[model samples]
Target: MTTLSHSPRHGPTRAVLRLHRVPLWVWTVLVIAGAGGLTWLYALGQEAASYGACGGTGMPECATEMRYWGSEHQSAKLLAWLPCGIAACAGAVLTGRELEHGTATLAWTQSVSPARWLAAKLAVPVVALLGGTTALTLMFRWVWGAGPDGGVNRWNSEYFHAAGSVGPAYVLLGLALGAPAALLTRRTLPAMGLALAGIGLAYHLGDRFRSSLWPASEVRGPWDSALNHVDQLEFGMIMESGERVSGLDCSDQAAPGDLGTCLSDHGAVDFYARIHPTSHYWPIQLVETGIALALAAAAVAAAFWVLRRRLP
Candidate 1:
């Protein structure tokens, strides 16, 4: 007698793709739409820049065109927070709904170990997110360069996060945080809320301390002369003894000359501005990305631990 054996049609990763196909399609559409929108915006920016002198006599048309372009850029800024939406979906639909509906248990019973199943759940979405965010980041960077000089600063939070590795890093962080939050909550709505809260907290902390990630360069000179066209972190008075004292309040000075006298009275020898020049952009981005990745690893570990504890 001859015996016939059949191989399984779907592996864990394939199963994940099948189950979450809707979200995958949505992600693809969003990425494609974002790329198209940015391309259009870039062309618009070029047109606006060609207007030699906007808001001038005989140039009323440029004024309207420039305003419309500026508004679009402002709307594009919200793209930086796209990962927050990813976090909520990961929590509510990916892990939480599966567990809540006992689908995870069914998967565990189908010869797939709990760990492998969880790994597939996280890995598939992570790969998708990385690809999507990377494309968006590159497109955003391209569009940003099309803007006129002094139109937008590189350090602007919206541009800063979306234009570099920081954007993808945050997306990974969201995925990491969402998995653990869903596992912990075991309920879709609560898990999603918790995940969003966690992401919001991370964003707050990252933005709050972004400047301090890298040591700022110091420029010291006369109060007015010390300022440079850079992202200034802090301003202080440099005493004759070479000590830096922040919070140099000279509001009492009624005249320009009195400003110097007030500063002198406070033992100020010169004004110093601690700033991050354009060169520091990559350094700051890499450092923040490293920090975010570290946090993500920890959250992933926590998720695995939670899974193990819940398993029989």
Candidate 2:
């Protein structure tokens, strides 16, 4: 009896490796085919023939407009979304399939800590997500090219775009959100459905948040100021204060207003600024990312805690 009680520590890790195999291949194909193709299309379809102040003659107008107002940022936005999309489908398939096919019980019996087991399952798709997203970012930088002064802003740069766009957060959120439903529903199709639905809902919510980030434009005085929507999360302040209307806050300036929230026509601007609460765009990205990822971690923890205690 004592001899028969074998503690096989690597069993769960091996099982996880097996599950990850297919996902790895799938991501490879996607990077080569999907990512590659999209990049080509983006490059080809850029504003080459259209907006050329130089008459599309002297220095390649396509690359010209791309220097300042290129669709590179837009391309990055679309590419960044892939990991989140992959995570949703992968999360649904990850262990949901196991539970559906009645293979989870067998998996659970293997000699492995519950923590390790769950972690192993989580790591594979996450790696794929990180790799694909990183590649797309690099490609975005390359194709978009750097203009005079390198034309690199936090909003457009790989680093800032990664943070601001909330791609990683999206993946984590999907994982967190899908896991609980998977546990409760215990079927691949239903779990997948719930995950997809949840992601769709998150999209709408995020869109609203994105739109709200840029405080409305103000037609104060002679300046018909137009804040670049692309730089919504970048510029510290769009407009300087002292007029009847306001745009954003400035750390360097502003004499300071009341301590608490006050409805000051432009009162909404103050409220929006206060709620946004980012000294700069970078901080806003950081806070948003932190909150999203933190929520995802909490969700995962709750799922495992509940499952472990309730089941065994």
Candidate 3:
């Protein structure tokens, strides 16, 4: 006859095991390295081009390319958001996947409490997410090249740095926000759907409030303002995204994006910049990330409180 003794430590140990099962860090490193390598290759090409183009100036063309590429202030949207999307999506599945695979119960039965299990589940990815994102951000910063004054080219691409600093938060917070949604639904697909919807809605609403959790200033374009924007109609007034219309009646053409606002404007279309005063770069990031995390914390707490007795 054999008797099972409760191993208080098993919960954390199992969690660690599960956390290590996935090689997210490896993929993250490879992605960063690949991106940096691509940047280096681009630099080489620019150097060669500059050599060919410059008559008197040695490497003038290369210098120009370096300025453009190295100044992360000007990366493309795709490059910026790809990592973010990856982090968000990967973390998005945290609890939903566990429930989907019927592993949550198994893990819980094996000496782990619901809270510990959930904590571990969320903690691992967030650590990895933030750490990996920070590393990636540094790499992109270095590779994109910096301005001679050690500043960044803020106009190269709209989403580059925006995606960089905030991407990590989005991914991590997105995951935190996802936990309760997944737990409530207990299905990966539905949970993921809810998570995405929540992210969009949260970002939209946050923008309406001009809260830093969602960066409203980074959007808009060089070809706006000439258009009088107004009356952004949202499905939930959650304010995901709005549009710009040329006519005085601000009800014409609208575009699709998260965190945008339509304003009544008729002037030279300069760019989509906030005419109103805004915070400094670092403070904005801090506030935005902090708010997002706070919201996520509330979400996690709500999920736990609601699901505490429901779990077996």
Which model scores highest in TM-score?
Answer: 1
Over 4 Å off in model 2, which ranges? 1-10, 34-74, 145-165, 210-220, 223-226, 229-279
Model 1: lDDT to the true structure: 0.79
Stretches of candidate 3 exceeding 4 Å from the true structure: 1-20, 23-26, 38-79, 145-164, 203-279
Model 3 score (lDDT): 0.56
Better candidate by lDDT, 1 or 2: 1
lDDT of 1 by residue, 182-269 (tens): 8988888888888888877888899899999999987775445224446778777888898998878565775678867977899887
Clashes of 1: 0
Worst 10 residues of 3 by lDDT: 230-239
For candidate 3, the clash count comes to: 9
Superposed by TM-score, candidate 1 places the C-alpha of residue 248 at a distance from the truth, in angstroms, of 3.6
Instruction: State TM-scores per candidate.
Output: 0.87, 0.65, 0.60
Superposed Cα deviation of residue 249, candidate 3 (Å): 20
**Which candidate leads the pack in lDDT?**
1
